[model samples]
Target: MKTLISGGTVVSLDPSIGDLARGDVLVDNGLITEVAAHIDAPDAEVIDACDRIVMPGFVDNHRHAWQTAFRGIGSDWTFPQWAAAMHGTVKAHYTPEDVYIGTLLGRLEALHSGVTTMLDWYHVAQTHEHEDAAIDALTDAPGRSVFCLGAGWGGGDSVDDDIRRVRARLSGGGRIDLALGMRGPGATGIDTAAREVKLADELGLRISLHIEAPGVITALHEHGLLRDTLTGVHANGIGEDELRLLADAGGSLSISPDVELKMGFGAPMTGVALAAGLRPTLSIDDVPSVGGDMFSTMRTAFAAQRGIDGGLRSRDLLDFATVDAAASMGLRDRTGSLTPGKDADIVLLRTDDVTIFPVTDPAASIVSHGHPGLVDTVLAAGRVVKRDGALVGVDLPALRTRLLASRDRIAEAAGVPLDGTWRPQP
Candidate 1:
């Protein structure tokens, strides 16, 4: 099968290919075959890309997709307060059905927003059935995903075995990949974290974890567990030494600027990461407490980093969500850039949209003024996931009903009110 996206401004993100003001992207058998000024494939389905910006789809490095149903539940709460409300109270009430609904809904939102690849930090897999439900949701979603199976809230004793079980069940490769999510030394202490890291290493699985302090990275280094496959999430409080250590170890960092700013994770480490010779990826973190799309994340990261230190470009912000993000997830060779041999994970934004009209520079316009509503079409692995400004084959009304019902049931069961407002105790 062949598809030709014709006559658009192509932002390949590949230094070799560069950006094409007017070009066509040719996809054959789920891979981009060519990107040039003209493509003359006679039997291909032609997608008109005129007056649009065609670029590689955004890759979100970290997100708690299971928290989708609880959106806006902790808008006014701090990190500790939100953690208490969510992990301490709400997570206990989620059924396997809730996990499925949340995961599917979140991935669908990613597709609608031109994010074809996402790293889902799913921590709601309390039971074996819950794990299966989460995996099923990822499988059903029409995009590439890395599901980082977590050690549930408060941690789990059998987390190693749980990871092994998940690996054995979903062993093969496809759009969905498996990773281990850990709480690191802060929550689990060095000894337990070391054991978990050893187990993941033996299983040959990539590891993702939260790093609120420099001590966590020190612990990983002490245990000799810091490597390229280790992705440190929220490296907000880490100092220069820690950042250099992480960069030297070839480990990636995921910075969620909006969540970090709102929840007091300190300023995002974008400038610090860059100065430390690291290209950190951007993420949405928890949608319940922050915005859920990459556009907001990119904009927030760019502005926040600039406020910390100037000399950042709109292209740099876009890279944090695309090429740099794919590198963080170990997917650079697969789907980051619109290179010829890479997977056809692409997003087409309408330059004619009200918020993004008068496209001066394609990359700048996308990073500075892009929104989910301006995403006109999205293709994942050469398959049309979103087209003509709508997600294909999705019944949004039905999904919304199911999600609302799940949210209500969870709140009622947990004995918590569903009010969106949060008040701090004096």
Candidate 2:
């Protein structure tokens, strides 16, 4: 099927031509066929894009998809305390049903906010049933995702069982891509990291690591596990040398500014990573604390970068949410920019929104004034997932109730009341 987007300000994101005003976009067979001033497709469905900011759909590079059920369950907790409570609960209490509800909520949220593609950094597979439940949730959603499958933090029989499930999922050849999600050197050492990376390489899959500190990469490199297949998350502590090694080794980094700030992980060096020949992208990290909106990540990243280095232009942050973000997800060839022959993952921003009224600059408007509510339309793989800021084909209220019930069960198992916070009194 072919569709033509008529007469809108297209942020083509194509470096060759850049942004165009009063442009036309054409989509055929789930890919952008053309993006020019005036296109003629006689048999295609035409849609008006008047006063819309048509750009590439946002890509959230790193996400804990199962955390959606506990969105507001970790408030007022420090990083250590929050992880102990929230992460521990997932390992001990989350059932297969919990995985299903949590992932569904998270995926639907991404669709609503114009995030067409996501990296589901799933690390809570306690049983084969749990793995099945997580995949079921993603399969039900409209957005695309890479399932970074892993065992629950229990780390013994759980890891072995999760690996078997991962193998089965890969063998099935479904929409889910199999990637290794490790707990890093702190939780698992260099030997374990190498084993996981090797498994991914053998299967031609990419591996994502949580680089909470510089030591994680150092340990991986020391053990000869750092390579193109490895991508680091929260690369805030790495210095110049470590950054170069990552760039040289063809590894990518995802800087989730909001989670980094809230957890006191220190300032993100996204600029420095880019300067060192790495276009380190950004992500929302997890829902609830950071919210599942890439716009929030873009805003926080831009403000943090500028606040640290004194100031920056607006286009700087847009790249983090679009092209740079796609690079982080290893999807530079599939989506990211509204380039011809790429997936038609597009986001139409309602520039006429009151919050962004008196718009000064288009790029600046996105970073400083834009929010999820301003996302007017979203298209993923040539299908309209959201129109006029409403999710299609999903009962959001019912999903929310399921998620809350799952949260209550988890809180009961953890022997704590999840009113609003996960921090237990010391």
Candidate 3:
């Protein structure tokens, strides 16, 4: 199938193409065929981009997708309180069905918001059934995904079988990749970190570590477990040296400002990561307390970055969401910029929306004024997952019903009633 997105401002993040005031993008099969000023593909399907800001689809570096069922229940939670509640009762009651519902909700919501590629930091695999449910939901979604399999905070048996099963299941050509959702050195000791990282390396899977505190990278590096395939999440409290260490080791950092600042994890590492010569990727982290929208993630990151480094620009943040983000997931060769020969992971944001009508600068408009509502169309792997401002093939009512049932059952089993504003009492 051939599709030509004709005549709009195209912000291809590809340095060669740059941003075109008026451009056209042609997609054949599942890859971008051409990005030029004009493309005369008479037989192809034409998507009018006259009022759209066409760009590469957003890539999220880190997200706890299974927490979608508990959205906003931790709004007033601190790091400690949230850990206790989220990792304690609710997690214990999670069944295979609950994980399936949550993963479906999260992945679908992510697509609606123009996030085509994401790393699901999955850690609720209490049993093989739970693992199956999560991976099944990932395959069911119409987007590029990385299943970062993890053991829960309480620690479980070897995840080798689960990881191997997933790898074998998704071995052939598809949109999903496998990774290790590790606890890292700070949370787990060095010996355990080394052991797990070695296993990931042997299996050829990327490692996504939660850099919970400072010196985590240093400690891991000292143990010779730090590798290029590692991606550190929430390096909020880490120092500049730690950032440099990560960069020197050829690893990437994912800054989730919303979760960090709100959860008292200290300030975002956006500015420092940049200063340390590392292109930091951005993510929503977890939607349990925040919305699963990449626009919100970009905006929060922009605000936090600009506050620390006044010279920060919207295009830089856009790069973090697009190209840099894909690099973090180790899928740069596949997606992340609107370049020819790359996967057609694209998003078309309408510039005619009430808040976006006066599109002065295209990239700036997307980073600053853009919202999920402005996302008029999205194409993942050259397939139209969302078009005309609605998700394709998704039953929202049915999904909501299933989600509610799952939440209710989990809450009941955990003996914790979920209130609209469930918080830690003084």
Candidate 4:
């Protein structure tokens, strides 16, 4: 199987190859084979990219895909308030089928919006059935994903067994990866955290933790458990010392600027990440609190960082959403760039639209104003998952119906209206 994306402005994101004003990308059997100014391949199927901006698909390193059914539910709440609602009431109402629908909805939406790779920080896998259901939905969807498992609520070493069981169940070497969506030292104390990290090492899996408070990195350092496989999600208030420690240990961060600012998690660490010697990665965090597309992630990180000190450029911010994000998610080699030898995770954004005319700047235009609707073609692992602005092989009506039903059911069970202001219980 072969695909030739001909004559598009390619943002290779690789410094050595550089950006191409007009280039062709060739994909063969799920891998990128050639990228040049022009390619002549009559045997391959040609996709016209004359009026598009061809680039690598976005990578969202941290998102609760299983919470997609609660989209926009806690938009007005603080981090603590949202946590109360989610951990206090809503999650208990989730059924296994609900998890399936939610995961499917999130992954499909991500693909449609040109996010070829995502790390699903699924913390609500309440049961064995729910875990299986979430993984099943993720596999069924058309995108690369990491199923980062977690212990439902409170910190416990009990989830180590769950991770071992689930990891063994998953077939190795595929689009879906298994990781530990851990409570970390923030929720679980250092002793338990040490145990969790050891377990992750034994299983040979990565760990993505919510770094909500200070001392978490310190705890990991004390235990000598920090490693490259550890990724801190939404690292809001950690100071330079913690950042340095993380960077020294080869750790990474996934910052959701939109969620951090709105939920009062403190300013995003985009500028700080750079200062502390770590390449920052952007994420949606959760659709219930922020927009799902990488465009929003890029712009939000840029604006928020600039609002503080004013340094990040559009090209640098674009890297946050693409290559940096892929590296943070531990998927740097498989995807993240239009370079040959990587998977064909690509997106073609239509540049002829009124919002993006003149063709002055590619990276700036994309980072500032690119959106899901502007995405015309998407390929994940050389498969055309989306074409002509619509998702391929997806039953829209059925998926929509399932999503709505799941949302309503969970909301009703929690004694909350699907559409109204949430009132906190005294």
**TM-score to native of every candidate shown:** 0.97, 0.94, 0.97, 0.98
Q: Which is the winner by TM-score between candidate 3 and candidate 4?
A: 4
* Clash pairs (backbone) in predicted model 3: 72-288
Stretches off by above 4 angstroms in model 4 are none
Q: Please, what is the whole-model Cα lDDT of each candidate in the order they appear? A: 0.87, 0.79, 0.87, 0.87
How does model 4 fare in lDDT?
0.87
Total clashes in model 3, counting residue pairs 3 or more apart in sequence or in different chains:
1
Off by more than 4 A, model 1: 154-156, 424-426
Better of 2 and 4 by TM-score: 4
lDDT of 1 by residue, 34-101 (tens): 99999999999999999989999999878888889988877878898877877878888988999999
Model 1, global lDDT: 0.87
Model 3 lDDT tens row, 1-426:
999999989999999998899999999998999999999999999999999999999998788889898888887788887877778668888889899999989999899999999888888768888888988899999999888888777353566777787788888957778898887766566777887888899988899888877778888878887889999888886889878988999999898888898999988888899889899889897877787898888899889878876878999999999899898877888889999999999999999888988999998898889999998999999999998999998989999999999988888887776766566442
Q: Model 2, residue 23: displacement in angstroms?
A: 0.8
Off by over 4 Å in 2: 154-161, 170-174
Q: How many residue pairs clash in each candidate?
A: 0, 0, 1, 0
lDDT-better candidate, 2 vs 3: 3
